[model samples]
Target: MKKLLLSILSIISLNVFAQPDVKFNITSDWGTGYCANINITPDQGYDDWEMVIKAPGGINSLWGANSVPIGGGEYKITPSPWKIPIATPFEIGFCGGGSSSDIEIISQSFTPTVTEVISEEIWIGENSSAYLNTGKEYYMVGINKDEPEASLHVGTNTSATSTSIVIETEGSDNAEINFQSGTGVSELNFQNGDLSDISSLTFSKNDNGATMSFYDKINSEEVIKVVDGSLYSREVVVQTDAFPDYVFSSDYNLASLSEVEASIDSLGHLPGVPAAEQVEEEGMSLSQITTIQMEKIEELTLYLIQQQKEIEALKKELNNLKK
Candidate 1:
């Protein structure tokens, strides 16, 4: 009976995020609509792919190939926060699969069909979003044709280190990130990525520095981990010798906008207050949440154990009957 109950709970929990909607054929709460999620309705070849990320009046696009299949099909991506989907200042994959060598966008705030960013990106109308901080890095997966470089200046004002962390688990011993030291702020962005593909991630921070990490390519939520004291650490995403299934598409509430805007001059976030914010109130620690989850797991384990005992007793009764 306990095992049966556990199985039922597990099935119900899977729908917390990745619920399939047949109309869009996309797996997710998609609780909110998309900025623009489109694939090639035309003839698309292996060498045709373009994704655009526009913020306010600014536009940026990455070009690539073999991004999407030729025909139409439903796909699940790491939970992407449409615009500023993650902690750092980075845009998720555009996922606009077509036979176009050029990809751009405008800041007009509502351009759905146009592949490039126009002067006024239609996606971002009048929203007063913030920009990427001084040193945080964003992600871009799939078609790596146009890997854009950051026009960042890491010097006297603030320190910055930018690098791309790809989870090609098949060729590496580990898929992890470790930020040793620094002051102002440090962050990591996983644009077009997936957590399953990554076996583990080891995150650490020292002193008064704060690290804002976003794995947009992960098919879940944007995890903004903070560390204020002298010691902070996390287990790295683990990856064995096999290539695991990666689905990117999750829910994310922005971390902090004001501070982010003041820090990253390049990153641009949504206008209104994010529905979910990760700001420290009077008294709240991530440890407490972890403890709660641990307790729940413990309860589940205990329940399962009791059920196992019941099963054993049932077997014994059956044996006696036979005798």
Candidate 2:
């Protein structure tokens, strides 16, 4: 809820002829309607004082003054003789049909006299509305709330369809919503874009030792988490560039059994394979390791085929020699 206070001040000097000191103060405004006070104080006193106001939405009721619609959103006001004396400063109050922003003082008639001055002040009393000021620096938007703990407090109890806050963006463009800490150094971002690859919603947190965790319905444990730039989950699936079926192509260079044995003896590992110590130090990716393993299996199959052909040739030569 928002409150708008409109105060129009006018000052007059008692020693010389000057403009009439008239002030308009909007004391209470509750969005759809408002109540205001018009205080008139001239340098001198007059028996009869009449003022006219222009209120586009019309005045519903008034006190301390007599009011009549002159024409075209303008009203003439005069001091109610029954309420106060004529020689002193007087105040007029009115309740208007619309917002306080619409009320304006159009004209007034008065004569000057030497009289006591009235100090200017505003009185904001209790009102039956959601907009309330509990204390200094405290504005509350709720029903039957006397005290608010925060600077701007909002409370509501309503149907299931009620929404507290909503922010949206329109048009084809990238959008981002950010939440930052009090230090202003750490932040979390929710982002979206127009392209297919970028159109998906992304959540990111930038900070030291930052961790984002998800929980089950019971919240007894963390089901998934991202900590220190790594992800931990019960299960994960990875997509790679392609499978290792290209190892079976005729253009692939397949090492013979002797060459593979020699390379393994010298390097203490299989040919084209990472060392055990290196893998332990810098880990390995599932996609890369899976492709490498599949390529080795395909090479083993080619070696078996070549060995079978040579075995068949030797068996034939032995049979011919026996004959």
Candidate 3:
């Protein structure tokens, strides 16, 4: 009877030890490198465990465990010396350069031994926060419902209330990229990966969403070059309904052609319909400027049509006189 009871107990232990649950997910991919998160849960409490993975390409870096290559595209990952409770899930992660699709877990081994367990500490609270130091870069990424959300940071650090760039999303359709500072105070400088100078852009936003604006500091030569480089194959149909009634209203001032030419002579550029500087000073947005420019272009087209008609009528009268 005693021998039979011991046999039954051993079989129950073996059954519990055989259950191993592991889940692996690729979190983010940036063409060359990718990040993955994994979770492991064993039915029986274990002092430690080892997981082996095979991938089409080599593993570059791993975190949350000690990993060593055992050759032949296999990496052995051992959890740090700590006991994991039965059926409790623990997470590990790695960032590697590989065929992101061709990763598989080949084997996992668990040692069910009683040992002192050290609890892992997580720093972030319900409201996440990170401390940024000057001259350093930080990247934070996570997966929610099989979608990746990420944020990148690089700049001189200041108080939490000061100017900074923040890009964030809520794992949904909405995303916001903000370059925040006092009104009209901050500028974003762009550069190539080789650190060569590109152009600078500025952004301003007020409490009203309509007041948001973007300004580019490219010189007139660069502007001309950009326009020359553009492709314009599509037919343009200017819809009169798109223009606001204010543009045609009697109260609005339309400068004479000579006045426009004089303004261009003084400013060294074709003046905006209401003066670009004045529009900017009044906090008009780029979209607002574009709308006003389109209206002026359509109005100029009408003036050209009227002049062509007058020229054709005068040519017909001159021919009749010659006849």
Candidate 4:
């Protein structure tokens, strides 16, 4: 696309250079017709400048000049009779019927030499810029660029080390790009200032119902993700109030195996653990679950120690009876 636009500008410039006296600039062009400014630079000290215009539909209206039908889809154009000699090189504004593509300057009579004009197209070259306006909003094509793709297209291949584009907003205001749809809208925002005086980046998906995931490039699998407002990761670490090591204390209450069995029978779950229905309804916290599991393991260890002591005491009593 860059090459194509450059080629087009080159063609327009070459055509203008073909006739050196006239510099044509298209002012505005609608589909059916166009208006233009034709800059005529005549030879030095010659103010009586006239040119022959050849168009498919012919010239309908002309200003800053006089026109006479010279036949063969052409108009013999000269300065208006009352229009005094203002400058050596002057400009003429004209409106013609049909597309600007069919208009051209066949000859001129500043000194019997001819010149040419332009078609309704963007003119981009060295030191030249063009803009297009569909309605009230204006769209510019080039800014310090030989050829540009369109509005908002920035940067080029160069050796200079500098940022291509920079955008700044007022203090305490967020600069955001809004993504809108029929159902809802999402925004990627750069929150700049607040009471905390810190900057942050935020992405809100609204109710788009799409999850964001991060993948491991080497493993080619998702390692972290967000789904339905929750975060998931392959590994996690949680901080809790305390661990189950306190169960080993001498004053700790240890339940007997029969007591634990009775509680399970009556409660339909472990004594200190949440029931399945409860966990399903109001999800489980990782820190709470970890502490509970460790506590159950410690209780089981205590039960094993008590049973070993009973077995030892019974063995001594049986030995005494044998004696």
Candidate 5:
């Protein structure tokens, strides 16, 4: 099967350098029809089928949104109304119904006859540092080709359940990487790779019958949460192949989510963007803490009884002295 690179870039500063003779195939569907508007979601190595046009020079003004529109071809190109001096990549896509089901990208890079990187790197801008920070906010909608899969690499912390993924900020939430299956997805993986520095994961599957597997790599612990009922951080739950079946670790890191939420470094805006911040704690630990607490109470009770006996002996000694 071929992979589709969907790039919905933020409309702004970013230099896209495309190699000459880069072939991309794209099919478009605007369910809402033409004249409908859409916004761009930007990403690096973020390839997709869309057109981006500028002020005919660099990043000046959007020339004509109506002029450069994608029709059909195996070649994926970012259209810029600006000068075509240097080989550049542009970000723009069809927006309608807010559903990406319509826009699909097919790459020629993959073939039984050949092999290459199925990726397209996008530059933040002329200045490399201009890219969005780890804490910076961005919207996302997962696409299910069949089995849903997502991967996020945080230089430090990363966590996920069957239905959600929470990325950590730099030193807290560094980077948010995701991969979703198209329509028929049933699994999510980081390709045996690792994701770190993630704060929280918020996942939803409208189709209840479909199954999803969420993978998290935090603190060298690889947790696999089959989304059907309860997970460690069960914010969004999806019914799995096992109905009424749920499993959670006897031990949970209560501070993990809070640590992630506090790390959303979106320039300090969107105060608590990480949904994990809103998850309600299950009060005292029933599986782990309760047992430990019970044991400690028993030990304390025994110690108290011994102390009481010692006091009685002291009282008897006092009477002997008086006599």
Candidate 6:
């Protein structure tokens, strides 16, 4: 976040005075909310101080002080009397409602006093975990000199238990992401390549699950890659009862050989084969076309089985006639 300081003027016995230094820092930021700390140091002693700040978003919650909206993105933040000491530094912290690019100190007011000069310093704790709200987005970035490794963890609580999704880079050349729901787990991985160049990862929830997408600077494209079967355990179950026999019946209207030939001639590929024109004109993805092709394969298999049965019956009748 960027900070801007305003010029301050003080009048003492008809003499002009310069204002003290004030600094602001945004300690934590979530998508919709953030926390910030402010420090004020005046050249002279004062009994009470009021600081005005112009923030991008309105203030939602504030602590270590009292504040009231004054209009036009400005808030009058006055520290309690007991909190400030004469000729001492004062600090205050607040959490805001919306995301902002920067915060600026617009103005200040304090009771001036004449006293011996004294140096003072005040420190405020950083709020690192302020951004860790459930169902909110957060990110972490780091660099390691010894070995390259980075990870992101997003967790949300449900009733008494919590669910978390983790994405991390393993060793020098592999990255993996996993989702945990009680005891069940699903993972996707990339092998033999480094993801160190990735600047950030964004995740959003959808009806089915969450979707993660990243931009590839080298390729100059936005890539969304989904990997299935990254982990290795499986079971198989065969359901013979569910097999379809409709392709053997006349009502099925299986595609004729001539129709298939014509399709190949006109489209330069079989029907349901992925084509650039089909995707561009019909707005179907390659994966969707591939699924259609698989269905066609199943239909063709049933037609071939029906033909084989007819051929076997003809041969048996011919043998009977010969005998």
**Error at 8, model 4, angstroms:** 39
Candidate 6's residue-wise lDDT over 191-279, tens digit each?
A: 32354453334444555565555545565555553234121223323334323444455787678778889999998877756777766
lDDT of 6 at 133: 19
For residues 1-323, write the lDDT of model 1, one tens digit per residue.
11122345444444322211211122222322223332223211111223332222211222221132222232222222233212122223332333222223311122121122111122322443323221215423222323223443222222365443344445656766555546433444433223234322324445556444444334554444445643323453433432211111133232343554664554343222221234344444445444444444544455576679999999999999999
lDDT of 4 by residue, 196-256 (tens): 3222222335365666655554445666667787888979988998999999999998888
Total residue pair clashes for candidate 2: 3
- Pairing residues by index, what is the TM-score of model 3? 0.32
lDDT of each: 0.34, 0.67, 0.61, 0.67, 0.36, 0.59
Stronger candidate by lDDT (3 vs 5): 3
Predicted candidate 5 versus true structure: per-residue lDDT over 1-323, tens digit per residue? 22333454322222333322333222343543222223332223332233332211112123223343333322233434342222234333332332333333343221110012222232255433332222215322233322123233223233553544455555654586664657544343342344444332335475444333444534434344445664444353333333211112234222333443565553342222223333344443343344444444544454566678989999999999999
Per-residue lDDT, model 3, residue 169, is 67
Model 4, position 231, has a per-residue lDDT of 87
> Lowest summed-lDDT stretch of 10 residues in model 3?
114-123
* Tens-digit per-residue lDDT, 1-323, candidate 3: 11122335455556645646788999998777788988876665565678889865888888778889999888998876543423367788888886778778898887653221111111333345433222226323322212223354344345465544455667675775556675554566676656655675444444432232233344412221112223232333444445555655657666667887898889866666566577658865555666777767766765677689999999999999999
Over 162-270, each residue of candidate 2 has an lDDT whose tens digit, in order, gives 6655566579755665655564334322223332221112234565576666544233555677778788888878788888788887798888889999999999999
- Clash totals for all candidate models: 53, 3, 0, 0, 64, 0
- The pairs that clash in candidate 6 are none
Considering TM-score, where higher is better, how would the candidates rank from best to worst?
A: 4, 2, 3, 6, 5, 1
How many clashes show up in model 6?
A: 0
- The deviation in Å at residue 214 for candidate 6 is 89
Model 6 weakest 10-residue run by lDDT: 115-124
Candidate 4 — number of clashing residue pairs?
0
